[model samples]
Target chain A: MLISNMEIIPGKQIQKHFGLVQGSSVRAKHVGRDIMASLKNIFGGELKGYTELLQESRDEAMDRMQQQAHAIGANAILNVRFSTSSVAQGAAEIYVYGTAVILE
Target chain B: MIELTIFLVLMTLGYLVGQYAEKKHYQSIIEREKRLSGLTTVASRFPPPGKQHDQCLVLGSVVISVDYFKRFIAMLRNLFGGRITSYEALLDRARRESLLRMKEQAAKMGAEYVFNVKYETASISKGRQNTIGSVEVLAYGTALMRPRDEA
Candidate 1:
C-alpha cells in the first residue's frame, strides 16, 4: 500500500521476503488506430487508440502484480518497473515487476 | 546502368521495410528478456525477510536505455508525435531488462530478500539528449538470515 521512491522506508519496517512476483498483460487495438495514425502523420494529431491500449494494459499488469504480492502477504512493493513489447503482428505485452515487502 | 539503378532502388526499399520489422521484433525480445530477468532458480535454503538475521544482503537495480540516435532515423519520425514514441519503447524495454538482471543477481547472492532497492536513470550520453540513451536501474536490498524466533 505504501509506495516510496526509495528501497527502505525512512521509518517503516519490513518483513518476510515474498518470492519475486510479476504480472504481464497482452493488449491490441483496432488496426484502425494505426491507419488513423498514419493519416495523422500528415495532419499531426493524437493517436488516441494506442494511448487507450497502453493505459488499459498498464492497469491490468499492475493489478496482477499486486495480486501476486498479496498472496505473499506483502504490504507494499519496491523498485517497481514497467516494460512493453509487441507479442505478435497486432498484439502487445506489458509487464510489471518489483520486490514485495511487508512491515512486520 | 539500368540494372544498377534497379538494384539500388530495391535495396532502399528493403532497408525501409527491414527497419520497421526490426523495431517491432527487437522491442519484443527485450520485453521477454525482462520478463524472464528475475530469479528463476530456487534457493536451497534461506531465512525469510524481517527475521533477526546477522548477515544482510543488498541489491541495486537499473534499466538499460536506447537513446534516439541508436535507433533508426524514421523512428525519430515516430518521436515528436504518435501515441507511442520510439523513445518510450526503448525505455520500456530497459526497465524490464534491468529488473530481470537485478533479480538474477539477488537469486545468485542467495539472499532471502532484496530490500532498499534503488533505480538510477542517466543519459549515458555524456550530455546529449539526441543520443540513444541508457537507463541504469539499480535495485538494492539487505539480505539477512534470521533465527526461528525472528521469523
Candidate 2:
C-alpha cells in the first residue's frame, strides 16, 4: 500500500522482503482537450488535464500492484519502479513492480 | 467546395500547431537536462546515519519519442485510439527524474542498495478533437543501494 521511489521509509520498519511482486496494465488516453490546450499554450501555464491523467495512471498501476502484494500478504512494497514501452500509436505499457514484504 | 476547403485548412493549421508544440516540449527538456546532467540523489532507510546511504548510477536520461514530428500528421487524422507517442518522452523524463531524486536521497541518508522499485503514469491533460491525448508518468522506487562492503 505504501510506495516511495526511495527504498527506505523513514519511520516504518521493514519486517520482510517480499521479493519480486508486481502488477501492470495497458493505458490509452482519450483526446478531448486539444482545443483548450492549444489556447492554454498561448496563455502559458501548467496543464491540469494531463496532470490528472498521469496521476490516474499511477493510481491504477499502484492498485494492481497492491492487489498482487495483498495476495502475497505483504504490507509494504520496496524499491518500486516503473518502465514504459510503446505498444502502439496511442497505447502504452504501465508496469508497477517491487519486493513484497511484511513490515512490523 | 468553400466549406470543404475551410475544413482542410483548419486541419492543416491544427496539424502544424500540434507539431510546433511537440518540438517545443522536447527543446525545453533538453535545456533542463543540461542543467541536471551531473546532479543526482542519495537516500537510506536505515537507522544511525553513519555510512548507510546507498548509491545508484544516473544513466543519462532521454525522453525518446516520435510524437514531436508526428503531432502534425496526428492532427490531420482523427480517432487515433490508443496509439499516440507523445507520452513516451514525458514518461521517460518522469522515470529518469524519479531515479535521479532517489539517488540523491539515498546518498543523503547514507544507505546503500535501494531495493524494490515501482513506477506509474496518468493523464495530466486530454488531447482535443483536433489532436490526441497527453499523459504524465510518475516513476518511483525504493532508493536501496548495496553497501560498499557488500559490493
Candidate 3:
C-alpha cells in the first residue's frame, strides 16, 4: 500500500476514505544497551544503539498500521503522523496513525 | 574522598569532550545546511498545484544523551527557577541535526521539496532518578519528487 504524510498526493484523487487506522509498539532497552548508553552519556554524543532501536520500533509500528489499513480494503494511507512516549522507566511506545483511503 | 574525586573527574571529562563534540557537530551542520539550501522544507500540508509528482515519506531521527556537566547544571537550574541553557543548546543541536539528516535523505531521492514536516521529541530515559537522561528527536515529512519520466 502507498503511504504518505501529506493530506493529498499530487496527481492522485481519493476515491474513498476508510477512516483512521493506528498502530503502536512498546519497547524497552536491554540492560547491556543501557549500560553502553550510560557510558556514552559521559561524553554527550549520539546514542547510535538507541537510535537504531527506536527506528526499528517505529518501522514496526508503521508496518502494523499498514497491515490494518490493508485489512480494511484501503490501498493507501495518507496524512500519517508519529508520536513517541515514555511509558515506563526503560520502555518507550512508538505510535503512528493515519487516514486509510483508496486512491485513483 | 575517592567518590568525590571520581565525580569531579567525570564532570571535567564530560565538559571538555562534550564541548568539543558540540562544536564539531555545529560546524558540520552549518556546512551541510548551506549545501542543501536549494531543497526546501515547509510545514504546509498542500503541495504546489498543477504539477504531478511522486510523494513518499522521509524521516531522520537521533538520540542524544546529556553529559555529566550539563546534567549537573540543569539540576542546579531546576532549583534556581531559571532557564536551563545547557539543555537549550543540547536540544537545539538535536533538532538541527535531525533536520539536516532528513534533508540529506530527500536529496538522495532527488526530491525537490519536503512538505508537512513535523518533529517529535521523547525523553527515552524518563522517570528513573539518577539515570543518564537522553532525548530522542524525530523529524519527518513527505518528499515530493518529479516523476521519473519528467526527470
The top-ranked prediction according to DockQ is: 3
lDDT (tens digit, per residue) of candidate 3 on B1-151? 9999999999999999999988898899899999999999999999999888888899999999888899888888777788888888888988998999899999999999999999999888887674437889999999989777876
Cα lDDT tens digits for candidate 2, B61-97: 2222223334544444445666444444445555655
DockQ of 1: 0.03
Choose 2 or 3, whichever is better by lDDT: 3
Interface RMSD, all models, one decimal each? 13.9, 8.8, 0.9
Q: Encode model 3's per-residue lDDT on A1-104: one tens digit a residue.
A: 88899888877889999999999999998989989998988889899989989999999999999999999999999999999998988789999999999998
Q: Write the per-residue lDDT of candidate 2 for residues A43-63, one digit (tens) a residue.
A: 223355544444466568778
Q: Which regions in candidate 1 have their CA more than 4 angstroms from the true location?
A: B1-151
Per-residue error for B53 in candidate 1, Å, reads 28
Task: Write candidate 1's Cα lDDT for A1-104 as tens digits.
Answer: 64332355433567766756789998766768767644433322123455456557767987898898888788887656666655554466767787888866
- Candidate 1, residues B1-151, lDDT tens digits: the string is 9998875655455455434544674676577566554433223233343445433334333323332223444355656755445556556555554445556665555544444444444332233334433333434334433344645
Off by over 4 Å in 3: B130-132
Sort by DockQ, best first.
Answer: 3, 2, 1
Clashing pairs in 3: none
List where candidate 2 sits over 4 angstroms from the true fold: A8-13, A31-51, B1-151
Global CA lDDT computed for model 1:
0.52
TM-score computed on alpha carbons, candidate 2: 0.45
